[model samples]
Target: MDPISLILGAILVGAAKGSGDVASGAVVDAYNGFREALRRRLAGRKPAQTAVEEYTADPDNWRPALETYLQQADAQKDEELLASASAVLSAADPDGASHGKYAVQIYGAQGVQVGDRNIQTNNYRSGP
Candidate 1:
């Protein structure tokens, strides 16, 4: 999966977990992988690492921190970290929906708003 897609998927999963949406053990393991990847990226950065741990422990409460870190990475253009995070996140999304199979394909003349969430698409051929 692409970096952006993977990151977004990770955020989605994290958000779902925060909202008490628990999946199979594999999903949790994947989430852990995502957390470990974040930890590794922020290694030696106490504040960042702490934030990650907080999110890992209480994803719902600390989800904002994860978003902050992801935004920070984007602002800083941390390609390597983004790539690494994406890979980890993609692995975690067992359904492989994070591969951008149909992401961001706005069609026709309709308006769409995805307020504070992520949307994945597949073969979006038209709009009304």
Candidate 2:
């Protein structure tokens, strides 16, 4: 396989494994801050310096405002958020089954079955 393919595959697999929700709030916060900063910039203001400085000065003050913005945006649904949280919990498991299970299912559906044998050869391999 090409090196790029390998890297891309790894990234997809990792993303499927999911991550904890601990940083999600922070991500939403930063996203809102940046968006707000852009708005300020477009309105003829120093966004990067002023907006970021104000945000950093009192994150608590921005939290409620960001939450309100998110609520109004309707970009993500409650089910979607719950799914994300579940994925995070599943990925944190020590057994590969939790995260790897989904990958295995996808591979199986695509007709790439892994048998009891340890060999990694694909079914599509050409033989003499």
RMSD of each: 9.0, 17.9
Task: Provide the lowest-lDDT 10-residue window in model 1.
Answer: 109-118
TM-score: model 2 vs. ground truth: 0.23
Regions more than 4 Å wrong, model 2: 1-59, 75-78, 89-128
The local distance difference test score of each candidate is 0.53, 0.35
| Candidate 1, position 54, lDDT | 67
Q: Write the per-residue lDDT of candidate 2 for residues 1-128, one digit (tens) a residue.
A: 22212222222233333334653543344334433433433344343234334443454455344334434433124334323333333343336434353233232244343322323444665688
- Candidate 1: list runs displaced more than 4 Å: 1-44, 69-76, 98-128
Report the C-alpha lDDT of model 1 over 22-128, residue by residue, as the tens digit: 55555565566665665666666676666655665676677567667656655225555555444444444535445554234444533353324545354556677
